[model samples]
Target: MHPRLKAVSFAVATLLAGAASAQSATHIAVTDAPDAQSATADAPASTALSRVTVQGARVRELPISSGALGARTDLETPFSTRQVTAEDLDARQVKSLGKIFANDASVMSLGDTFSFNAYSINVRGIPLDDYNGYKINGLPFFMTTVELPVESFESVQLLKGSSGFMYGFGAPGGIINFVTKKPTDKTLFSADLGYRSDGVFSEHIDAGGRVGDDRRFGYRLNLTHEQGDTYNGANVQRNSGSLGLDARLTSALTWTADAIYQSRRVKGGVQDFFLDDFNGDTLPKAPSGRKNLGAAYDNTFFNSNVFFVSSGLRWQIDPNWSAKVDVSRSQDRRRYSGQWMGLLNGAGDYTVYLNKAQGAATYEQAQALVEGEFTAAGLRHQVTLGLAWQGLNKQTVPKSLYTPIGQENLYAPITPLSWNGSYDDSLQYHNYHSAQKAVFASDTVQFSEQWSALLGLRYSDYDQTSFNTAGTVTNQYHKTPVTPTVALMFRARPDTLLYASYVESLEQGSTVGQTYVNKDEVLAPLKSRQYEIGAKHEGRDWGATAALFEIDRGAEYANAQNVYVSNGQIRLRGAELNGYWNLPAGLRLTGSAAWTAGKYRETDAELVGHRLEGIPKWQGSIGASQKIPGVEGLSANAELHYYARFDADSANKYKLPGYSTVNLGVSYETQIAAHPVTLRAGVDNVFNRNYWGFLQSGYTFVGAPRTLGVNAKIEL
Candidate 1:
């Protein structure tokens, strides 16, 4: 066994032993939007041992939005769910979505440091692109090829597994709900400044308040700017701003609006290297982590502007029933310019292609639902019936040119070659539109105090059309897909629950990834299914979850005869164990481990039983934090992440090395000039270990090297 794995095993064993032998400890259920430093408060002395229960397990729930299903506690939901709170963001100094989920065993980051505006992740061995994996308060919104404006969000909730019954068509990975910061009755103001080892500087301002004495008018505004060198030694600058407003028209109705703008520019950015670029089948040694191998003239520019408005009317017609209607529309204009460079050989010779494009996309969406409490056959039940509609219209024009940047050694790079300004006019304008309408119903039946069941079904109608540059319809599709979910839960103990679920999800045909012979052709919609069994335990200061799951997704690939077809499937089976504990004193621990096996089950002979590329069979992470006994407002934390070796190609011709990394952080809270202030600093990859970062898409990039960052926030 590897020395690192043996060490991890020993540590885990010690932790388990400690958890079992420790004396009584204080436990606090995590709440929504908790005060930043509440967790560090000293625990009160008590003679009796107290049982810890999850906040959601109780009748009173946190004041937060719960996607399409409305507000419900974690225990009320019939799926695996997790929330990343605002406090977590500040404590970790999380600047990117990738860093936010780094410790999560179920998620894997695919975007490298220089991916500038792009953000992608794989959930439970299933990859979800920026477009269809995100939501803003239950309304489907596309991140496209841009980073999410995480500063404007109050909290992020992840519903793991299939969510087709709640969301329309999407990957089975899961649903990510980004709840925006809402207008508060109390005045709020905050400012933050940050610096990174790469010479990056960041400034952010957030302010929100109720303007009118009646407190019916509220507004929240945020502005952020970041500029400097990235981990890959690439130059980047980003500017973004957002304004959110809310007005209460009546006791039962409310209106909300938001405007967001972002502009980013990147120079000398680099992406993952393809296996074909190397000299031999075996993977070559990676370049220096700090090396920027791209041409000096290579640049990428991205700009986006969005305007959105939404209104909701909630009526409590009677004591046992309530109805809500939500309507929203959004318009987004996006522009991109720059050349993409990819290494063509180990010698650092690269192929550069200029890609300039302008695009616009519009989304109109509405949803209505009625929730009622009733008794059926002596069993208490909560039922929800909802209807939703969404329409998308997109148009894009490509002014592209291709060129080659001459060879340059990775160890000693040279200046980029100049372009001749020649262009490619072969491609035409691309336009596409899609509409999705669905009706869904769910019932949570309490058979007894110890047993409950949840059942849901959704009927979706999706239509899409493609148009040529001349405005002629080139292709059209009309599809109706039905998805269903059923789950059963039993309370093994007052603080423990056992559950089993079976669910199905739907995904529209992919218009990206031209791996097939027929490139750029949209495939058919896909249907996927999942079966999972899990157990959850919540205590006063600790919680744990374990789950076993199997998933199958429809796939498409070229056959033996080189014919592109959609008669293929992929299967994944996995198990996960995750938990957190706040031990006696001010010590805290968090850990997670996952193992999965994925393969092409139904495909050509060469592909059958082959392991999925970029998916490690074993992964785990452990993190801990401790408060300084001598310092009242000081804490320190450390984390370790591990990944097993995996192949970089479906054919198993190239293998990437496994790696492990460590991170350390420190935070101090104090009062500065009568204002609460927090200072935080952290360093990742402390050992400066070099490793290969493999993506499910068969791309590879060098992992980040040792880097340091610090940030300070003051409540004004």
Candidate 2:
């Protein structure tokens, strides 16, 4: 076994042994379950003790962080957001972001999990910035071609639209924050064994408890491993480990730390197809997803490793005031060798080439914040003040190798010529660096019982530099911008809220790719603005939200000359509705629908009024869950997703057909040897549909076919 694997295995065994010994020596009482209404109040204890194999009676309220603005519930915040809990992850057996948001109308996958080294997604017809789009515990992290292990997180939260005041600099599309699981008040241990069709198997272990005298010290640990052949003739192996620790030094002071590591490798992975040279007016027929077009000796693989650590302290100064400070560091390393096929004509003929590269990215961040509530001038006010600093450094090979191998037909497959090439770590050099510093403040004033207003502002200093192969700076940029946000909210009733909000944000410029004439050139920063109006209602057994939004953002794309440049403006207007009902007779129903109209507003006359590429006009999903009346602890669920046809390119000369898919799952819970056990089975793409999953940068990926998964879990 590899040295790292051996060490991980030993650590997992040691932790499990220690937990088992502790369990046998002492008895820890589990806390009472909190009602759904108070789900966000005592989340750690309540969620840890609750059953997660089946859907709960109501949607649990989850708190989301608004960067420097602090934490707020959906009904309290003036933004569109969604939260996926740990229970949802377990019940669906989701392993990737694509599957996690499959039923979300506002999110669309940009890459597939099985074919790409890492998955990517877009919101509101705009792609997320790799550097600024993601966060861990509200701290910035690198997310380009990186996938985190879902098993280690307590919940995944999504914030939609421009957030310049909330976060320093980011994509206008949205922000995704991953919340880590913390130590539990009671002793807990669980293990799971799982299998997927095509010979994939996995094992996972989770443990948490309070240790030390007086139970002042706490710890949480998770370990996972999976290895096997995939449904598309590829082999994958993954291993991960995570640890969280906390110490309560006093009644009002607490210190916490977290560390996570993961390594994944894939062999014979599917390659993406490019259609830049194709002149056809319509997309060609898609091939079966199960077919492997590459040769058996195709030397292709992807390897990735990630490590992260963070430490923080929370201080409660009296009852109405609090303070927090945190620091974090993260590193991502990747190596890959693959072939990309480029279409040469209207027919299925294509040319193949080899691409090889290795790179690494390191990020560091520090932040401090204070929040307080006070009454002044006969008005109540909640205030927040914070400061943050973050930096990123990237290393890449001096030069990537791209050589043509041979030719092949998509319909009639044939083995192409192979070239011998490998990546050399010794040739790596520093390629890019960026830094940001910002101070922000926000005030929410309650003028009356039914009226309130919010005002926020952030001043950010941003700098970036790009280096050539010889370690000499080629380009540098510096900017100081002030972003602001304003909102007005009215409480119609205790359970309903109506609000209007406006926000502005600044985004990092795009980098030109090798295929463009201006390769390696970095454009100037782009500014975006958003306006939205929304309403939210939270009932005893039902809830719903509706919103209308419009955004104007700077546009950058390859021009007719194939030179990438920033010019013109892009406008997008949309409306969305989402609701859930926990009805009688053990039945629950949830649905969502979205309508978007995207167009090129100004700039090039020929491109004006053109529809945005890869964004559908309409998308929606409906889901149903039912519990068996005769048998206890048994439940079933089904969901269906639909999409409308969309443009395939900016010129609007080609179009890709839309398709629908269905997923079904069933779960059963029982007791075995006085221990609680749960079994689950699921099937995806029940109709075995074959269609284009996603399109980006003139490249298309084939969707996955029918697949089955089964798992059994036991808690002690």
Candidate 1 segments whose C-alpha is farther than 4 A from its true place: 1-68, 250-253, 276-279, 299-309, 316-319, 331-333, 337-358, 424-430, 514-517, 557-565
Q: What TM-scores do the predictions have? A: 0.88, 0.91
* Per-residue lDDT of model 1, residues 403-499, tens digit only: 4444455556646756556554435464788899899888889988889898888898899888777888877989888888888888767766777
Q: Lowest-lDDT window of 10 residues in candidate 2?
A: 41-50
**lDDT for position 198 in model 2:** 72
Report the number of clashing residue pairs per model: 5, 0
Which residue pairs collide, candidate 1?
Answer: 27-540, 27-541, 28-540, 52-539, 52-540
In candidate 1 the C-alpha lDDT for residue 303 amounts to: 56
Q: Candidate 1: lDDT over CA atoms?
A: 0.67
| Whole-model Cα lDDT of every candidate shown, in order | 0.67, 0.75
The whole-model C-alpha lDDT of candidate 2 against the native structure comes to 0.75
Q: Which pairs of residues clash in candidate 2, taking residues 3 or more apart in a chain or in different chains?
A: none
